[model samples]
Target: RDLCADFECEPAEFNGAANHVHLLVNLPPKVALSRLVNSLKRVSSRRMRTEFPEPARHYYRANTLWSDFSFAGSVGGTPISVLRQYIEQHNRPV
Candidate 1:
C-alpha cells in the first residue's frame, strides 16, 4: 500500500519464513533501488510498531524493525512467468 502510494511500485508477491521475507515488486523506471528500499523499511517499521506493539516491543527494543542490510536484484532479464513460479514454489507452507 505504502509502496504504491509513495513510490508507484506495485507489490506482486510477499512471502516469509520465521526470520525473513521476500517481496517481489514492480518498480517504475524512475525509482532508485536504494531509495525504494529505505522507504519500505522505514514505513514498514513505523507501521509495525504502531499496529503490533507487543511483537514490536519484543523484537525491536531499539525501535528498529529491519536490519541495516537488505538484498535486492533485477528480474528484468528473466521471464515473469518463471519468476512468479519460483516465488510461489519457494514460499513456506502455512
Candidate 2:
C-alpha cells in the first residue's frame, strides 16, 4: 500500500485472515528488518486508528495494532521455488 510504496519497498505477496497478516516484501538493501517492521506497524496502526474509526474502536488503549515481535529468516542462497514450496507446505496451514 501507500506506506510500503513510500518506503521504497514492494509487497510481493500478502495473505491473511481476520487476525493476522503475512507479507512477502522486497525492500531496499538499506532497510533493516527491524526498522522496516517497526515502521510498518507504527505507521499502519496510526493510519488505521485515524482513518477507520469504527474498526479502531476494537484496538486496545495501547499504541499498537500489531504484535511487537515478528518472525524472520534469512533467505540467502535459497531458490524461490524451494522456499515457496517449503512455505506452502509447512507454513500455509498455520
Task: Provide the overall lDDT of each model, using Cα atoms, as 2-decimal numbers.
Answer: 0.79, 0.70
lDDT per residue, candidate 2, 1-94, as tens digits? 7878877888765655556666777788887877777888888778787898777767645666787778765567877666555444433311
Could you tell me the lDDT of residue 64 within candidate 1?
Answer: 81
Q: Residue 43 in model 1: shift from native, Å?
A: 0.8
Per model, how many backbone clashes are there?
Answer: 0, 0
TM-score of each: 0.83, 0.69
Residue pairs in candidate 1 whose N, alpha carbon or C atoms collide under 3 angstroms: none
User: In model 1, which runs have C-alpha deviations exceeding 4 angstroms?
Assistant: 91-94
Q: What is the lDDT of residue 12 in candidate 2?
A: 66
Give the RMSD in angstroms, all C-alphas superposed, for model 1: 2.2
